[model samples]
Target: MRHVVAAVAGLIFALGLGISGMTDPGKVIGFLDVGGAWEPALAFVMGGAVVVYALAYRLIVRRPRPVVEVKFSLPTAKKVTTSLVVGSALFGIGWGLGGYCPGPALTSVVSGSWEVGLFVVTMLAGMGLHQVWERLSARGSAAAAPAPAAPLAEGPLKGVDA
Candidate 1:
């Protein structure tokens, strides 16, 4: 049931991308061009998405758990770290250079363009490299961790053994 629903939702999303000309590199690049041959059409699509997400996020964050999850696993990180800044810059550079971020890149794949294929391949490689780097970094940090302390003495179940 979930798979079917997911497929339907993905189809709808892909259709939206196609209809909005997101699958076309020209359209995307035009939007980014700004001072030169700028197209503001995609901005409306993005604006609509932002509005929808803002409303949905406001409602969802109030809930203790999501309908399909045991608990909310939201990001707890609050600080703007170096990795975040570098990753964001890379993302923006890729989007500007290729005119196809991940979503549009995947949607554009059906067109059988070799350039898009190459972009997706490199994107996957970049993700894999990041995963490897993260694991290595974590291992180095975890190696320096002190021995585990005793379990919590105070919480929702204070003094209660689990």
Candidate 2:
């Protein structure tokens, strides 16, 4: 039931992207291109989305639990670190370069565009690389962690240094 709802929601979102011209790279790039033939349609779309989300969140978040989920898992982290800043910058740069953010790019995949395929592949690769980096970081931190003191010997060897 949850899967069905999620699938339906995703389909609706994709349809919205397509209908709003978000799935078009040219339109997105044009929107980004300030001081040129800059488009304002996406800006209006985003503003409308934000307003809707704000209203929906204000109402929905008051509920004790979600309809499908046990509870809402909101982000706990509040501190902004260097990694966060760098990752955001990278994401923005990638979006500007490719003229397609993750949502739109994923939605555009069904269009059979080779550029979209390449973008998806590289995006997946970047995600995989981040996973590898995270694993290595975890291992390194584990290795660097100090070990606990060993317990004393029992019985006859309790007093013995060796």
Best by lDDT: 2
lDDT of 2 by residue, 1-162 (tens): 889998999999888888888988889889988889888789977887899989999999999999989998675445665767888899888887989988889998888889999999999999899767766765666577644221211222321221
User: Roughly what TM-score does model 2 have, to 2 decimal places?
Assistant: 0.84
Worst 10 residues of 1 by lDDT: 150-159
**Model 2: lowest-lDDT 10 consecutive positions:** 150-159
Residue 10 error for model 2, in Å? 0.6
TM-scores, all models, native as reference: 0.78, 0.84
Off by over 4 Å in 1: 143-162
Candidate 2, residue 27: the lDDT equals 90
Candidate achieving the largest TM-score: 2
Candidate 1, residues 70-140, lDDT tens digits: the string is 78666554566676688889989989999998888898888898999999999999889976776675566
**lDDT of each candidate versus the true structure:** 0.78, 0.79
What is the alpha-carbon lDDT for the whole of candidate 1? 0.78
